[model samples]
Target: MEQTHSRVAVVTGGSGGIGRAVAERLGADGMNVVVAYSGNTERAAEVVKAVEAAGGRAVAGRADVAEPDEVDALFDTAEREFGGVDVVVNTAGIMILKPLVEFDLDDLDRMHRTNIRGTFVVSRAAARRLRSGGALINFSTSVTRLALPTYSAYAASKGAVDALTLVLARELRGRDITVNAVAPGPTATPLFLDGKPQEVVERMAGQAPLERLGTPDDIATAVAFLAGPARWVNGQVVYVNGGIA
Candidate 1:
């Protein structure tokens, strides 16, 4: 792969899990990175150090993806530090699982606030600021297609993301920017494994023909492709689920 030393990438939720992997991968690909975190300053700092250790430029910025002002500042940090924005990967979201009838409205509201509204806020900024030839990558869930139980609200949010990605791609015609979403399934991240039992994890892992869970690096690889070489792949939801969906 050719090094993209001239490109700049902004990755939200970059402190941990898949977001961290995306940040590190883009930095390794020779892009200057802005690691945006909501709260975890220590972890965000660690990601910045990792990127710099790999001989790439990086900085950590604290921003709530749902807030327009903070997101604006995040883009500003990238521009002020790295020259301009080129790639934006929004991996910031919250997932709450429960049957639709039994789900709490408060939880639903909170999840939508982060998952739906946050994606919109960040994406709107990218649409306005990303340089030509830039890519905007959003996170989605394979459950939207899987139609799995207890994923109604989560699925609904990602469904909205799918719509946003496709529409935005067309809206940017002739601008040379790509808008896309990555829908991952049953990834073995702290966010997915925190409360599930081992048997439940095993069962879901077996659902995929590959018979395993996805790693953060697996999702990161797809994001890196869209961010750099996959220029023709736009306005599409690329499923990286090991064929489970």
Candidate 2:
């Protein structure tokens, strides 16, 4: 594997939301970054520019996390541009909220494809390619623990992520790589706020002890810890939910 003095990170869904924050935070920490986006080439390019402006090297690539070939190419981009990957943050996922009885199977399948299978594909590549001392960070949700109504399908999908993170962490034993998940609650991102009414958002925000919606930076700070100095932390789901759960 090619190696470099600076650590390198590949952040899926890195064009916006928590993923974009993670990419930018890692770059600000002096790591080379590959910002992978499913669509929105312009936003991805903006992230790359932001990273570079922060005094870090970065490149943006388009990849569908659910597709193995695309994910492989994503990792290849990391290696080609940054030498080697020291961190893999799979923050690419979709959420559809509905009561189980009212949920559409197609939506469930779509969510599973991106949230579960996408994680698996990326984790598989990271397992084989990450250098020693690397970290694999997956995204989950506090809803898995909150068990809120209308979030049945979305919660179920993240529950799988929780399971995957723990098991994969153990499976990567002896590799000196840590696998973990960050579960955020009531984050004020476009994904979480797109359809909710202001009242509903405020109610959920108040559920957390912090009494406000979490900013992307709040979650990214936790990810930065896992990716950089939290070596002793492994196979754990660090909930950055401000005590919501």
Q: Please, what is the whole-model Cα lDDT of each candidate in the order they appear?
A: 0.94, 0.91
Among the numbered candidates, top lDDT falls to 1
Cα lDDT of model 2 by residue, 193-240, tens digit? 999999999899898877999999999999999999899999999999
Q: Candidate 1 lDDT, tens digit per residue, 1-245?
A: 35354899999999979999999898899889999999999999999998888667999999999999999999999989988999999999998899999999999999999999999999999999999889999999999999989999999999999999999999999999999999999999988998899999999999999999999999999999999999999999999999999
Give the 10-residue window scoring lowest on summed lDDT in candidate 1.
1-10
Give candidates' CA RMSD values in order. 1.7, 1.8
What does candidate 1 score on TM? Answer: 0.97
